[model samples]
Target: MKWYGASQRRGTLSRLAPDGKDVKAVTLYTHTFFLIEDGRSDEQKQPHYTAVGATPEEAEAMAFAVYQRAMDCNHAMQQKGPMLIECSHCGIQRRVLLPPAPPVAVTRKAERRFFNLF
Candidate 1:
């Protein structure tokens, strides 16, 4: 997905999900699960998941951390700033503050459609 400009001073920025639909911001949050096997029942436990922040500062920190961790092994990390991260569980959306001047584009190419197959 292409990144857009920074959020509007802690406001909800409409973003398209991987499916190319207008999904709520909260849908971006990813959840980490822990397996807990009990004697009788097996259950999955989730301690914490990544989430966007209400303020620019908080959003920036979260986005930076995510970027750093993802590219730590490769050593090819790009700086980022306030971004919108969605909550995987609750479907809550928030503005995550990131580094200053995050890589984002103001516009994107229009989506192409294919006709019926022959």
Candidate 2:
């Protein structure tokens, strides 16, 4: 997907490690996934983050995994959708819309503030 910032750009499917070692034909299989490596490591060899999938189906399942991982990695992460898919070949991007979160319960004390207006 077309993310708005440079950092987001780095998180695209194109930047993900291929399912295999073949550099020429890198296909994102079901197991092919990406992860946001922990950035706290002092050694450069330690991955800042990582994502993986075991099968094509797993890859699809991991879409949400990655999104959650990103959110967990950065609480400020604001994505338009809960899941996103990008085709490395044609550069097509699609997003999977998650069901809206349940409305929060308002406490009686908070409700009283609005009642005064009524």
Candidate 3:
């Protein structure tokens, strides 16, 4: 009835079901993702990055790693430039493209403003 995290790196929490089988619940924010064209055209892509990941620190590190790899692939491709990066799930390893990094939410302190007509 309850689940606990298996580890920090893994994004899963598991528990036993009524039938004595393992029920693995995929934890949010633990999947790795990057920006790529969604087949819209040759030069334009969807205006968003796919999201997934690990811990805050780990996720940032992973995203940066993908960026680095993409840069390498870009050099190899030459004129084709960049736009594809390797995916962990996909088997074809010629590689794919990745952009710099995913956008992060900005947190700021709220400021209360009042009319000060003196």
Indicate which candidate wins on lDDT.
Answer: 2
lDDT of 1 at 28: 29
**Per-residue accuracy of model 3 over 1-118 as CA lDDT, tens digit each:** 1112111122433334354465554444442333344433322322112224545555545544544454334322222236533334321123345757988999998776677543
Q: In model 3, how many backbone clashes occur?
A: 8
State the lDDT of candidate 1 residue by residue for 1-118, as single tens digits. 2223211112344445554565545422332221122332222221122435655556656654543343223323232324644444333233345558767878988866676432
Evaluate model 3: give its lDDT: 0.37
Runs of candidate 2 exceeding 4 Å displacement: 1-51, 75-118
Q: How many residue pairs clash in each candidate?
A: 16, 14, 8
Error of 2 at 26 (Å): 13
Candidate 2: C-alpha lDDT: 0.38
Q: Which sections of candidate 1 miss by over 4 Å? A: 1-51, 73-118
Model 1 earns a TM-score of 0.22
TM-score of each: 0.22, 0.21, 0.28
Per-candidate local distance difference test:
0.37, 0.38, 0.37
Higher-TM-score candidate among 2 and 3?
Answer: 3
Point to the candidate with the largest TM-score.
Answer: 3
Tens digits of per-residue lDDT, candidate 2, 1-118, equal 4211112212213334556665443444432223323543332222122234444555545554555444434333234345644433322233445679999998775544666785
Ranking by TM-score: 3, 1, 2
